[model samples]
Target chain A: MQYRISFPHMGKYYIPIKKAMEAFVGNYGEVILPPPITKRTIELGALHSPDFVCVPFKYTLGNFIEALENGANVLFQIAGDCRLGFYSEVQEQILQDLDFDFTFHMMELNGKNAKGLYEVFKAMNPELTLPKVVSTLAVVVRIVYAMDGIEKYIRQNIGFEVEKGGFERIEKQFLAEIATAETMPQAGRIFKKYLKKLKTVALNKPAKPLRVGVVGELYVLMEPFSNYFIEKELAKFGIEVERFITASYLIFSTQHNVKKILKQADGYVSYEIGADGTDSVAKSVVMAKKGYDGIIHLKPFGCTPEVNSIPMVNKISEDFEIPVLYFSFDAQTSETGVKTRLEAFYDMLEMKKRGRAL
Target chain B: MKAYLGVDIGSISTKGVIIDGDNRIIANEYLWTEGNPIAAVKGVVESLQKQIAPEVQVMAVGTTGSARKLIGVVLNAQIVKNEITTHAIGTMSRVPDVRTILEIGGQDSKIILLRNGIVTDYAMNTICAAGTGSFLMSQAKRLGLAIEELGEMALQSENPTRIAARCTVFAESDLVHKAQIGHKKEDIVAGICTAVVNNYLNNVGKGKRILAPIVFQGGVSKNVGVVRAFEQILGHEIYVDEFGHLMGCLGAAVLAKNSGVEQLFDFNIQEVDFVTKGRECELCSNNCEIIYIYRNNEVLDAWGNRCERGLSA
Candidate 1:
């Protein structure tokens, strides 16, 4: 039996993890989900590591430790920018020092070439044929495409749904169905059906609630784990949530769409926040004028780009007369405090709306 | 007879300044980001709208900051530039003899080394909070002293004690230890100042040749204690311009004036319909989840990219 192992990303950008796992599982056997992330995990990593390492490094290291404890011998990591590429080695050394027995495959280390892909596949399944690897990759690609399409549709329309929990319930069902789906056609059908249902729910003949746009760092905004499930919590308040950040947009549509977005901004904001602050600022203005009630800004602690953009964002808020609630997330942030503030913010908006109507 | 506006957006603050043909400050606003760039810009614009003379229509606008591209798009700014260029231009325009610039803001710190008014080497500590304004603010809060008072109190110290000038955790414990040993509050405050200055020098200003005629700006420039600390460390009387906080905005405005461009624009950014979505970028292993901004139904801008792959700016 082959055990499938994948690390946890801060959010839905888990596609790469999923893709890597699929390739490994096809060659090996069943894939095991990595252990859940927690404060203890982070502590474990921090205790064993240097103090200057970034938070992601520590969290990932903790994740690997937990996965190994759960009998995950095969570890998968994708090499990329920043310290992440180097983290694999450091973490490997740490794990080895702790006397854990495991095999690690670093994808993208030799560059994303055919040879690297073949080597990874071969490492996972020494007896597997090349045809099997190709077929498995094709299936993984299809899954990724379907998942992206479904999520994109959901993001655009989630704010407009007339029935509360309809979109979320469907999304939950869709994720589960796709995870275990046997064929690409089956997953496609499930996606189509859910998309139709979501559209119908969103377009129901009724007045929509006040839409509040959320924008900020991708990790904090999209990953419920990182930001304490802020989006889900916001939805529970009956406020329509509009968010314009997603992985698909960055990877596929950024080159074609950023220019159009810039023109739309029309010189209201001076720059993008960090990497995405510009997008958040432009979207906040659009939502304000589009009759949205407020804007919520989020960012990871120590994010320089967002920090630089705050002044401009405040300017947008003042010019539009829109109230914006800002939150900075770190590992030590208190979830209870965040919830309390969010609830109060919603109440304040509600009171303002009532006063205006009266 | 046309005037231009320049907005400098930084991680810690947003600044806007207006200038006439002769490069005089017509209007300006400085505000804390509080983690909201859109709101911050809106505040700057509203303040500018009120401050601008009724007869002087804003002919052109330029934006520069970490968020310059987004703010530029939102404000219809004609030119957007990096903080280094914007800050240098703004400082050189004010203090032409400025050979070194030391700027410490809320979240980050920068050291600009200049030769003959040209930036030779510069380093920024975007990742550390050890030496920034926020660190000092928090330390002040811990000491139960107002941030404004800490600087003045430090000036009063006859014998400044030494505190750990490394990380926040170490510094905090060190401060407590010194206080427990009956160190005077004034001396402790001075120690804190020295620690912050030392931390900045070690982390951001390391291995860089800091020249004379230094200009210290950014949010931290307001602290007289930090100014004194720098003077003691660098052995030079640092120049803090009357409008030091507004230098970035001034620089952006200067650029706008130099470009000789005119575009009729409204400061009312509230009327525009914008939306944003956040997703993870899975193109490579980086998995950089990006935020996409949209105006109406069209994509307006994108940010939160670790690499330049997803953004044009």
Candidate 2:
């Protein structure tokens, strides 16, 4: 029985996910990747989901439905620290109630380290040996770190590429090559080759391109469509982007940096926020110190941690002398509304860079 | 003699302005969008064309507001900008000392902070239309009063009743309940005014500094009741320009003048035919819905594909 497993999409994180699955299954199984989130995806998810739940829930539920339709029997729900823990229980119940035959596995329910993830892998594959799991997990971790590093470079240079779509073309090539790897060593080689190729791309970035830092809720920050392709829009204006939220950040944030965050977020927040609130607070100061022209805080509407972080983020913006634009997105947000605000933001950043005279 | 044309097309209202080389408004027109932006834009264009002097040909065109993109494409505009930038430019051109701009249109409200003729920060009401002009207008109709008279009644109140303005539905029902409780019309109107000011402060104005030397504009700025409510709540004198409702178009005209892009904009384009077609591509699971704009049987532009597979790029 070849078990077909699937995971929801979040930007380029799918690259590392495919590599990990290739390592563990090694041609013994197939992976079912969900289609991109479209209007139909949201409708299906929203129709079955309880209203007022966070936007990511609806998106992941949609992903699950689409994956099931594509002949996947196993579904993985990667929940975060906050209200995300209960998502699988509710989603599984809904999917089962709809009479779908599938095995649901919820991982990282309590933010455990590698051992917890290993347990999940072992449960998924009872024939899996401890040594095999350890080797596969180690390779996957390294792949994630490498992928994140490459993306950082991509984000910095993609905005100023001399040839339009040059960086994106190379990025698509990297994903394709990485997905075909059959072993941990092969994956590492593929990533290294891409890094070398990425460095060769020509970029005509200005001596000092206006810099913008994006900090927000975990899902909203990672997913492009969720926030209306904000990073791409900024790139259109020749602005370099800095983003700290990613799958790697979530994994590393497991041990805790709340104390450092509390110190940085002093006078604004007195305690630790469950999700990316503290991280959002800390990154603002970092962006300010790095002299970014502006910052944008994006989160799905009704997200608690992001809502709580807004006033403090505004305070930070004032103290650091950097402007911050906040966008609370929901299903109801129109594309034109988002586009106009972004253009306005770009206008402000350009004015600030040019020393502010109407 | 060169003239610049600027159009501000929104979901609720459409406004157009034509200005000469001196940035003097030669002609302007304001009309309701009425759920059809293309028709309303055509109406504004025809009106402005008729009003402007024949020798002063339109040299450039600019567009701003929610429907700016569609109208810009249709008019072959030289400049297309968002309302925020246009509003700031327009306010600064008129009120040179303006530090803040509080604008509430038919369904949306925005607060912009400017320092030294540059926008420092800004915020818009997210996912809520409470306290906007349309909200107040509907509430006025429910009270059997003309929307114009509602403001006058609000000013006559000696003691105002309280009504919730966080949500339009809640505010409307709350107004009815207040009226049922035997509250006077003036008091209820005043209460609605205060509630709008408070709602603007808490929602759109959240975490924003409401400084002095603020210019209040947009359709809602015409309401003396809301203006007075804002003055009381903000503890500062709010300045309202005579052309407050036309600022978006005014700014767009200024931007066109500054853009220095020499595009001959002919009003004769009204004789042309334009159509938009939308279709879903079923090649892949992405199922991207592509939109194509055509002019006289020629494909003008196409967009809205997720990947290169579906896109002609």
Candidate 3:
């Protein structure tokens, strides 16, 4: 049996590519990485998709189309929050509409939907044993956890380093070394060494360098695709960046943290900001009092909660004498404009600090 | 002597509201967004600066809207919030007992359910523009009637026609069909109003229990026809505040006041020149277009990126 496996885009290709190649080679044949996402892929997806569908929907459809064209008989996609959960059926319809010969397996499509998943696996790997599939999934989970751990540590400390590019260089080395590691222990060793080296890179600056806490809508913050890399750019200016949003954090600790965040705002107001507004406002206030240099809030073009929380944030900024910058991202927004204002804000803060000393 | 500044930037319009500590509206201006939030915000800020009394200093600045962040950043706002929270706060302050909020703006509509003065559940339709202010504007244009006259014109009908109220395509076709059949102008206007309300009810308010006292807001709240249609469909009286379009801005002002901490903010943003650039991410199939902002050859901020690929770069 010649099995075909595919992975999407850069960075994710590292582990999945290795794993797929190993697993398929061990069983039957070879693995092929899906063609890079291009304008053509998006066009194809748009052509086949329902008009005015969300951009993600069109892109995912295009990915599947490209994968099928590359002779991939089996497709894998991780299921999660938002519209991604329902995208599989929609994508399947579009694929079937085009009459592609392929089998689809969406992991986490309700754990109880085991029979359907098993049938898909059986078709892809007729000699597949339940134990083997479980073990493969376990390995993949471990790799994901390890990658996430490395990413989390790097994100928090990368901005604090005294020397520019030190963290990134080590991060690159760590990724390269980890990719070559055959076992979890080797990946762990690589992570530990790089983390130590990262800590040693002195990040000493003025005791206070306009610490800006970025808090707002999740998509505009985490996805980088959505917010246009605001956090990284802020970090480049040596601003101590604090953003408490991530897919992992949202899934694991959001419910628990939300209560704590709300409780922190006890005396100010009891109203919620709809969706994540409450959380953003709470976090922004906390950061304001924490003596952070400034606060930068980001949200999507049409998001509601962030819109509601602006007043509260302004009040906090007024009360604390701290500056807060807000940014809304959309397709037409100019990055040049955002950066110019940010630099001016940074300069103004620096001037204020100098004037106070005088 | 305490004063607050509120900036509400929506898809279609950007509004600025200045209020005294006693919650009295001092100065307010509403202008079309013209598809550029940055320019609209700049216009709002410039207009607001001129409106402020020389004797009364701006104690706090708050921003709310779809473009709150960008505007907040540009204006150096003290507080920034989402539209729902801003609207809820604004409405609760004025009408204290609002249980439901039906906000239909230029490009979107939202049905917010409030229980015991707190937002319990809410649904928003941003993808579709059929039952929003734009829909009304389109119909008004087709009928050669100004949007402001739609409500009273609709109310004038003794016998209202029933038009399709699904997607824009079906609604437009039904309207043409009704006109071809020589339906009275008033009846057609009433039918269009009912159609828009029906579309909103089926899409945004679907699967949600709407209870009163319901508050209708956003730019479309000014349309009495929509308000009447909502009341007829939900079988409850709907209230539209005099300053309905300014609710988000009002909420932002209220929040600004409640924020106990006082900071001296300088509104000198106009003195600085800001520039921005755009790029596309090639790392993922998502191909998210990103923009990078620069000030004096230094990267000030970046946005529009989808994932981590372009973030660090």
User: What does candidate 3's lDDT look like per residue over A1-358, in tens digits?
Assistant: 5777654443333463457345534566556666765556657767887764445556557767887898876666656444556667777777888899776667662323335544555666667666565555444444555566666665555667766788778777766766665555665676677667767777765566657778886656655534546667767766767766544355444343656868876545476656668878888778877888777788765566777787787677667767666676644456555654465455435535554100
- Compare the candidates by DockQ and give the number of the best one: 2
Model 2 lDDT tens row, A211-317: 99999898888889888888898898899999987776667544346777777665577787768887788788878888999999998888888877877788889
Residues B1-313, candidate 1, lDDT per residue (tens digit)? Answer: 5788989877778889888887788888888777778788888888888888788878888898777777887787877766666777788788877888999888778776655555544556634589889999998998999999988999999888899998988999999999999999999999999999999998778656688889998888888888999999989998988898888778788777777677877766777776667887665443556888887779977775655775643
Error of 2 at B250 (Å): 0.9
lDDT of each: 0.72, 0.83, 0.70
lDDT for model 1 comes to 0.72
Superposition TM-score, candidate 3 onto the true structure: 0.60
Model 3 residue B41 CA deviation in Å: 3.1
Interface RMSD of 3: 15.3
**lDDT of model 2 at residue B232?**
89
Cα lDDT tens digits for candidate 1, A1-358: 5655656455544544465456555646555555555556667767777676555666677778877887877777656444556878988898899999877767662212445566666766787566665555555555566667776666545645666668778777777766665566766787787777667775432264656788876656766666777766676666666776655454344332556666555576654433565677667767777877788888766555666656666677667767677777665665545764565466546545654100
Q: Which candidate number maximizes lDDT? A: 2
Q: How well does candidate 1 reproduce the true complex, by DockQ? A: 0.02
Score residue A45 of candidate 1 by CA lDDT. Answer: 68
Q: How close is candidate 2 to the true structure, as a TM-score?
A: 0.95
